[model samples]
Target chain A: MADLILLFFLLVCAVTAVAQRELLNSAIILSIYSLIMAVVWVRLGAVDVAITEASVGAGISTVLFIAVLTRVKRREEITRFRVQVLPLIVVLAVGAALIYGTLDMPDFGSAAAVSNTHVVPRYLEKGVEETGTDNYVAAILASYRGYDTLGETTVIFTAGLCVVLLIRSEKKRRL
Target chain B: MMDFILAKYNFWIYVIIMMIGFYAVIAKSNLIKKIIGLNIFQTSVFLLFISIGKVEGGTVPIYQGVEAVYINPLPHVLILTAIVVGVSITAVAFALVVNIYREYGTIEENAILEMSKTDD
Candidate 1:
């Protein structure tokens, strides 16, 4: 039943992407998509990832796109069609390959899996002593992968700066 | 039946939501609509995380009776942080949107492009 739901949601995403005529409505659909995705992540047991996805994926990215949108005016007709036959074929082939790879993955949250048996046990047992932090995800993210986190922070900062530089104006438009 | 419904079918539904959101951000010409789509995308991800922490017959991760079997509290903590981050990002995005609206007379992508070309 869950699988069916997931399949249906995938259809929704595909339809939303391809069928929507109004950009604003598309954005709203995207927000719904993000919320739905958060639910999926929780089910998958990747709570940390889900948190990031919810915040950065749905929240920040949506806002950024909206801000960028304000700088432009809606055109009655699309001037360019970014879809090209070659790129479309390439994307489809890549997507197929990815789906094929999924066949090899362990069943979600199987105790036999390496993630549950090896790394996770160690974290659960000794993470407190090692990091002196109650939040293991925080410990892993901030300490174990501190450098990567720093890099990610820098990336966000840079993105924010770029957007500001690109869109800031000396005067205001009333519209 | 319930397990199959919750475990198997739910994942795909979330994936489709993501695609819809992605489509809105990419295909739509309107800026505000794109933002809305992006929000939908993000919210789906949050739902995914919350679902991950759920254990069958488990209660909320709070202090309770000795008989209670606790679900992992870590995900809950992480989400708390994520909530704050989401809000901050939204605030910043709104600031940018206001600026963008002021600079450009409209919110459509093609119109902005035309205006740019004419100016050059």
Candidate 2:
């Protein structure tokens, strides 16, 4: 039941991505899409992932996109020039192969999944004891993957600097 | 029959909400309206998360020396941080929007494109 709803939502987001006309509009939709993906992550028992998605994906990225949009507002009218059937066929073939590789996988919610058998159980048990934090997700994100988070933060800072460089001019516009 | 009905109907309803948010984003040219759609989409995801975190008969996590079950606190804490992030992003986006309006004199994307083309 829930799976069907999630699948349907995914389809909707895809449609929204393609159908939007304005660049700014599309960017906004993209933010929304990111937000929805966060929820999906949480529903799938990936609360930590959801937090990152909501913050970085939906929040920070959206701001970056809008900043870029401010500089270049209008999208170049997309014209489908050539029939690129060969590329499409190749892409589809690769996608199908990937899907086929997962044929022997356990059911989605099965306890035997790698996520459960692997690091998750250990984290669930030892996370609080080791980190001494009530929120294990935060501990994992800030401690276990501290280097990755630092890298991500640096990337965000770089993006912000780039935006400032691009928009800044000899005669600064009054904000 | 109950499970069948739940599966058949509830799934589509969530889909429709998501699509509406997505469609609004894709269809509208107005920057603000698109943000609104984004909010809708973001909120829907929040709903999904909250729903998933919900355990039947679960009480609030706060304990007053009572032995009642509680819905997981993990999702709530995560959401609190997420909401702050969402607001910050919105603030930055709006700031840019203001800057765009200042420089371009118009927020409409098509018009700006046309203006840039002629200037070029």
Candidate 3:
């Protein structure tokens, strides 16, 4: 029941956020959207995801969006006479296709679901045995899937370097 | 009837949220707005994945007494990596947007296209 309300509120925030004309307002609304999403993740028993979402989705991304706003124009220009029908059609088609795809998915929370049966039990059974970590999620992430995590960390490193290079180029151009 | 709706309502709501972000990404003109739209879209995808991981009576994946059902922690780990990636990418994107503004003097998509056309 509570989850239902949170989902509805998320939908509302998502709509209001996208519909806002002012870029600052849109960014602010998106922050709220992330916060609510974090709560919903907690409600779903995903405590780690909730914490990460709260910090990253609400914390880092909002600041980045707002900081860039200072460099760019505050208000979005409302151009006229542009035919935007193509994007609308494309969005509608994609949404419909996604809805169609969801129809065959297993009912939520069924223990017999494919996602539950495939390799999950082994993780639950031998996860701590193999990795020696107390937390199953931690065991899988840092050990079973450590290589992927390494690549992800590298991606973050690359992005940071890229941002620094961009700033440096701007300074050189000014000189 | 109500049973079916109650079971899958979360998925349906997230689909709506996803579409809202999708529309903003496709239809919005401001570069900042487009980035914001992408943020919305990414978080919604996170919600969808986490929701799928829920077990009705599951607890957190952290060690508890044996024989307790913990929600699928796989999705949480994957999405954690994804959330970090999303944040870093957003930073890079913003840096790029700042550069674009400096070069073209406008952040609107149409205006940038016009500037490029004249330069070509």
In terms of DockQ, the best-performing candidate is 3
Could you estimate the TM-score for every candidate? 0.58, 0.53, 0.96
lDDT of 3 at A141: 88
lDDT of 2 at A25: 69
Local accuracy by lDDT, each model: 0.54, 0.55, 0.85
Displacement of the residue A127 alpha carbon in candidate 3, Å: 2.3
**Which runs in model 3 stand beyond 4 Å of their true positions?**
A81-83
User: Candidate 1 vs candidate 2: which has greater DockQ?
Assistant: 1
What are the DockQ scores of the candidates, in order? 0.18, 0.08, 0.80
What is the lDDT, from 0 to 100, of the residue B92 in candidate 2? 50
Model 1, residue B57: displacement in angstroms?
A: 10
Clashing pairs in 2: A20-B26
Best by TM-score: 3
How close is candidate 3 at the interface, in terms of C-alpha RMSD after superposing the true interface residues?
A: 1.1
Q: After TM-score superposition, what is the CA distance of residue A77 in candidate 2 from its true location, in Å?
A: 1.0
Model 3: DockQ vs. true structure: 0.80
Ranking by DockQ: 3, 1, 2
Candidate 2 residues A57-175, lDDT tens each?
78776776676565654453434544345544553464456345434434333345343356544555666678877565566566665665566566556546644653474137443
- Top-lDDT candidate index: 3
Better of 2 and 3 by TM-score: 3
lDDT of 2 by residue, B86-118 (tens): 554555555566566666776665666778899
Write the number of the candidate with greater lDDT, choosing between 1 and 2.
Answer: 2
RMSD, one per candidate, in order: 6.4, 8.7, 1.5
